[model samples]
Target: MSVRGRRASFISAGVRFIVILGLSVASCWPFRQSQDIEFTFLLPPGRVECFYQPVAKNGSMEVEYQVIAGAGMDVDFTIVSPHGYLLTSDFRKSDGIHTVEPTEEGDYRICFDNSFSRVSEKMVFFEVILDGQGAEGGGDDEWADMVEPESMLEYKLEDIRESVESVHRRLERSRQMQTLLRAFEARDRNLLEDNLWRVSFWSCVSLLVMLGVALTQVYTLRSLFHDKRRVHT
Candidate 1:
């Protein structure tokens, strides 16, 4: 090949490689239509708090909740479907996880009830994960239009895309696990602190009682001894 033709061919090859790599990365990028909500709320005594989440048909929903702080460390939880059906209900539960698959395309209700505990309020931590709803990625047609039908680049791109997707899924799971662990840790810490406070308060009260009794005993003994010495004299 002539110098100019050689240069032209090299430039074309470089452009093709770049295009393939770009398409691969774009297609493999995680375009999740999923919604993740994490919330911590206080449920007052004699009250019920409810939240709504809209989900599409054939989608999946997962709800996890924990009563992190309260008198009893428990609350009543309920899930209602779009059609006013009760899907799950738990009374006086400390923690729970619920899943709904192939959900109806409407609003779902989640409620926490603290009416039974008329004196103690509750602190709740909850998470909702909605998956497989409006995912929008994978530009396969764009890749096909830019590459030859049987090119080696196409196969390499497919491999790269799969690898990227696999890594993305693993990372997502890892993140979810970490979040759950943090919630648990917070609950445990709160419990420990509460217990410690109670113990310290009672210890102080007992110490004060002991000191009062000891002083009274010492005074009574001195008075009795003084009376006896006077009678002897």
Candidate 2:
């Protein structure tokens, strides 16, 4: 081939290669989903509820809970490991988070206790997230077979996804915190109402007692001061 013709051929081949690589990346984009679940339930007085969550060894399990409504807006919480060891114990807590790294590969128990409550049913909100460390980097070697630029782009995309996921998680945490604040406000309001009612009731009782004493003394004094007109006619 002549020099000018060879240059034109090389340019066309480069353009074709760029387009093919773009299409390939577009066709096989990688995405992984993290596990997260939330639940809300009513816990009746004097009852205990337990949930079993399966986690692999070295994996992390995160749990968060809030008591939205009840007499004291609190409940007893416990976490038990698969090997029958106590992992966490919270007594009459309103809201909190607990994270555990499992040493045994089996089901872990999470229990909510309303046994100390006798009058009110509790509304509990809980979230469970499993951080699967075992799956990370399991597929990275496949990217090594690709060209360096392609591999770098893929990793960057993965990092972007991670950042987006992190933002989403923060938003969720904010929402949960707002809910917890509202619940606390409600509990305070209820306590204020009960106190007001008690004060009013006691005031009324005191007023009635004072009135009775006053009337009784007045009648006794009038009877003692009666004129001596027993034998007029």
Candidate 3:
């Protein structure tokens, strides 16, 4: 083969490798073991909210929750199995994490109860993670079709797969960290707002009290001066 033609062929092969790698990564995204559902909601006083997640037999589920903003920053949390069996329960907690390994395939119920807090509504953040249930498959056949068995690229498939999985795990960790950080930020913001209001209110009250004391002193001094003048006259 001519030098130019060989170079062109090399470039084409590289391009194909990159394209196939990208497609394989994209195809694997939907098959991640840990699928997460996250939500933030306002739970009014004396109200309860429940959510359901379906899990396959032998699958695992996790629930994490935080009370980001509210009067007491606490709520009652509960998890129930599909067979009406209570799996977990926490009373008046500000944050919690629970995990369940189900023996039966069905929907599990997760609930947040605010009935104990009759006057203050709560802002709740929660995440549900379903694991051990992803479909098992890969794009190995696609890679095989694009690359010859004798080619050097075929030898690197295992390495490529490992790298993709590592990257995916890192992304999942990053996502979870971001979620927790957001919840912390929201709680901090609420605390700052509350402190600001309390400070402003007390400052105003102090100012009013100081003014009242000054006025009272002025009035007493003037009355005494008038009495002294009358006595001298």
Candidate 4:
């Protein structure tokens, strides 16, 4: 539009940027913390894990996982939803940390399933560290207290029971898949074995046919030679 209007727009944009920067700096100052949560579960089937983490609106989790185990089996992770939906992996840190930012606010269950191979020892051990929450406002003690601490994430268990069921359903699905694969392999092996004797029998018959053809050719050649000898005589 007009020069004055254009100037006003630029000034307005600059002011908004300054305001955002100021708020960001103030938030980093940090005052109080919400809560700390920590809990562990012994996986009956395989290793499963969950940690309360605050993810950015567009960033990874505010809480990060650090896994340690033999062959990192302690870190072998499978994620599932309580609603019978499978969760996908977003990112894994160099230290075998997993992080994801949820776009929706609701109950989410992540299972660290290691129930693939029966031979594999059902071993999965892992822990996570949580950072504080973030928003445009500076975290006040009142606000922080309203939130849960990173260390005390156990309270979510009661709140996430349905999520646990979701995990169970996912595990069931995994089991089904494994069973199907095994059946397929068995069928393939049986098919191969069933045809083995037939294949061998046919191969022997073909060999016999070739031998007979050779013998007939030899007899025909001998007869021709004897005729020529008689003519020479």
lDDT scores of the candidates, listed in order: 0.85, 0.76, 0.83, 0.45
- Model 1, residue 57: distance off in Å is 0.4
Measured with C-alpha atoms, the lDDT of residue 225 in candidate 1 is 75
What does candidate 1 score in Cα RMSD to the true structure? Answer: 4.5
Assess candidate 1 and give its lDDT.
0.85
Best by lDDT: 1
Mind giving the per-residue lDDT tens digits that candidate 1 earns over 9-123? 9778967886777575765554556678999999999999999999999989999999888889999999999999999999999999999998999999999999999999989
Put down candidate 4 lDDT per residue, 28-109, tens digits, no spaces. Answer: 4343222233333444444345533333233233222333222223334444433446555533221244544443333345
TM values, all candidates: 0.81, 0.59, 0.78, 0.31
Q: Best candidate per TM-score, number?
A: 1
What candidate 3 gets wrong by more than 4 Å, as runs, is 1-30, 136-156, 228-233
Q: Could you tell me how far off, in angstroms, the CA of residue 95 lies in candidate 2 after the best superposition? A: 3.5
Ranking by lDDT: 1, 3, 2, 4
**Model 4, residue 33: C-alpha shift (Å):** 42
Say what the RMSD of model 4 is.
18.0
Instruction: Give the clash count for each candidate.
Output: 0, 0, 0, 17
Q: Least accurate stretch of 10 residues (summed lDDT) in model 4?
A: 62-71
